[model samples]
Target chain A: EAGVAQSPRYKIIEKRQSVAFWCNPISGHATLYWYQQILGQGPKLLIQFQNNGVVDDSQLPKDRFSAERLKGVDSTLKIQPAKLEDSAVYLCASELSGANVLTFGAGSRLTVL
Target chain B: AQSVAQPEDQVNVAEGNPLTVKCTYSVSGNPYLFWYVQYPNRGLQFLLKYITGDNLVKGSYGFEAEFNKSQTSFHLKKPSALVSDSALYFCAVRAAPGGRRALTFGSGTRLQVQP
Candidate 1:
C-alpha cells in the first residue's frame, strides 16, 4: 500500500512570510493527522481530521496556523507570518478508523530565517 | 491527558550486542503504547504497538517491546544491534478507546550502534 505523501520536501522563508504544506494520506484511511517536530523534540500534534471534520485542534497555534482537509483524503497546513520558532518538520500521518497503528509520510521540512 | 517519557537522550551499543531503549507513559485510562524509529530527514516509522493480548510485542527490524503495566513502561529491545539500527526512537501513548485519540510523544532517544 502507498504510504502517506507530503509535498515540497523542503521550504525556506523569512519570518513574517507565509508557507503551506500539502499531505495526501493513504488510500481509504479515514483519519489524518498533522504534527510538528522541532529539533531535539518529539512530534507534537497540530491538528487531526476525521473525514473532513476536525476532531482536534486544541494544540494548534490558531493565530498563525490553519489547516483543512476538504475532501477527507488530502490536507493542507498553512502558517502565516511564520515565526522563527516555526522552523521544523511538518509530518502527516494516517490510520484506519479505529485502528491502533499509524503510517507517516516523509514530511516537509521548513526553515524560517 | 496522556504523556510519554524517554529518560535517555541516547544509548550506545556495539554491533552484535544487545540493545535496549527505555520508555514510560502516563494516561488517565487504558493506554495504547507505540514505538517508532526516525531516520535522519525522514518521518517516523512504526516499530510496534501494545494494545492488548500480549505483554511482549515483536515489531519490524527485529525489534521487540515489553509492556509492563505495573511499571508503566514499554521498553524496546533487540538481541543484536546493527550499525543500521542507529537512529532516533520515539515513544508515544494515547488513551485507549475514549477521550481524545491523538498520541502524545516523548522527546525521543537517539540510538547509536557502533560497528
Candidate 2:
C-alpha cells in the first residue's frame, strides 16, 4: 500500500506572506491529522479530522492558521500572514480509526523569513 | 492536561552496546503511552505503544519500553545498539478516561549510535 503523500517538500516565504500545504493520506484511512513540528521540538497537533468532520482543533491558531479535510481523503493546511515563529515542518498523518496506528508523510518544511 | 518529557537531550552509544532514552509523562487517570522515531528529513514513525497490558512492551526495530506507573515513566530501551538506530526519538501520551485521542509529545531525544 502507498504511504501518505505531501506536496512541496520545502517552502520559503517572507513574513506576512500567505502559504498553504497539501496532504494526501493513504488509501482507506479514515482519520487525518495535521501537526506543526518546530526545530528541536516534537510535533504539536494543529487539527484532526475523522472522515471530513473535525474531531479536534482546539490548539489551532484560529487567527492565522486553518485546515480542511474535504471528502475525507485529502487535506490542506494554510497559514496567512506568516510570522517568523511559524517556521516549522508541517506533518500529515492518517490512521484507520481511533485505535489504529498512524502513518506519517515526509512533511512540508516551511521557512518564514 | 496531558504532557510528556524526554529528560535527555541526546544519548551516545557505541555499536553493540545497550541504549536507553528516558521519558516521563503526566496525565489524568490511566495513560496510553507511545514511542516514535524520526529519521533525518522524514516524518515520525511509530515504534511502539502501551495501552493496557504488560508494563513491558516490545516494539518495531528491536526497541522496547518499560512503563513504570509508580514513577510515571516510560523509558525506551534497546539491548544492542545499531548505527542505523541513530535518530530523534519522541515519547507521547494520551489520557485514558477521556474520549480524546490526541497525543501529547515530548520535546524529543536524539540518539547517536556510533560504529
DockQ, all candidates in order:
0.71, 0.65
Angstrom error of the Cα, residue B69, model 1: value is 0.7
TM-score of each: 0.98, 0.96
Per-residue lDDT of candidate 2, residues B2-78 (tens digit): 89989999999999999999999999889989999999999999999998889999999899999999999999999
Pairs with backbone N, CA or C atoms under 3 Å apart (clashes), candidate 2: none
The complex in candidate 1 yields a DockQ of 0.71
Number of the top-ranking candidate, with DockQ as the measure:
1
- Model 2 score (lDDT): 0.92
Q: Which segments of candidate 2 are over 4 A away from where they belong?
A: B97-99
**Pairing residues by index, what is the TM-score of model 2?**
0.96
Task: Go through the candidates in order and give each one's C-alpha lDDT.
Answer: 0.94, 0.92
Mind giving the per-residue lDDT tens digits that candidate 2 earns over A11-47? 9999999999999999988889899999999999999
